[model samples]
Target: MSKKLIAIASTGGHYVQLSRIMKQANFDSNDILYVRTKVNANDTPSFENESLIEDVSRDTLIRSPIIAFQMLKLILKHKPKWIITTGAMPGLISIVIGRLLLRKTMWVDSIANTKQLSASGRIAKKIAHKTLTQWPDLVGENVQYKGRVI
Candidate 1:
């Protein structure tokens, strides 16, 4: 049987963290697609099973709608069994929409920044099928501490 499809993160700490977890999953490159803000213009590495979206910063009002449309398109096209992310604007939106669309969702808060739970992590606690936190003590009843991402 084929492994279930997944929508992975695209850039920065979230991307780095997600990449680590994805390596442990049974899914292959074709079984997952990446949704990131933007591709590094200089780093032209061959990305076979990835897609990019404009990175939505907190200051941009238009970020949500653009990300929503892109996420909707990817959800329709890929039909992933689960959507996973680390807290960030785009990740938060993806988790919410994924739940609404009946896709299993997992949110893992970044471990490096152990100081606080992100806004996305808080929202995910309310809606995600599973809210994964790195800090055991920081996890609430709604959240699950799944250990460090590394």
Candidate 2:
């Protein structure tokens, strides 16, 4: 079957959170395309269908264009119907490109953002098909308080 979902996140906590959700999501392995930030030479993929993008953040604006290009390429190659993230910057970028491709997108704000949504998450609320916060207190009209990854 063609992969229908592009599941993305940055490294560390974001990646861990996304991984946890994917494990419980019960999506067929063949229908999922996982994406994560490329961290190091040891960054071997855990899933059969996975891609890595250079790690970039707001502080690294110069690198964003590169990431955008990468996201576009991946979106074109995978042609996923849905894009989901437990994000930092890369995942957020993926959602933007995926949305431009008319793909459905979901953003799960990191559990670490207990006080507020991450910068990327805040933007995602405006564009993503669904935006979820781990903390119930953070939920509002556009953001939902789904159970957390942690």
Which candidate should be chosen as best, given lDDT against the real structure? 2
- Clash pairs, candidate 1, are 37-55
Instruction: Please give the distance, in angstroms, between residue 41's alpha carbon in candidate 2 and its true position after superposition.
Output: 5.3
Q: Which ten residues in a row have the lowest lDDT in candidate 1?
A: 1-10
What would you estimate as the lDDT of candidate 1?
Answer: 0.76
lDDT of 1 by residue, 1-150 (tens): 222555556478888888878887756777777666676655432476667776666688577888888888888777888888875778888888898889999888888657667866777788889888898878777887867878
By summed lDDT, which 10 consecutive residues of candidate 2 come out lowest? 39-48
The TM-score between candidate 2 and the true structure equals: 0.94
Residue 102 displacement in candidate 2 (angstroms): 0.2
Error of 1 at 105 (Å): 0.6
Q: Any runs in candidate 2 off by more than 4 Å, and if so which?
A: none
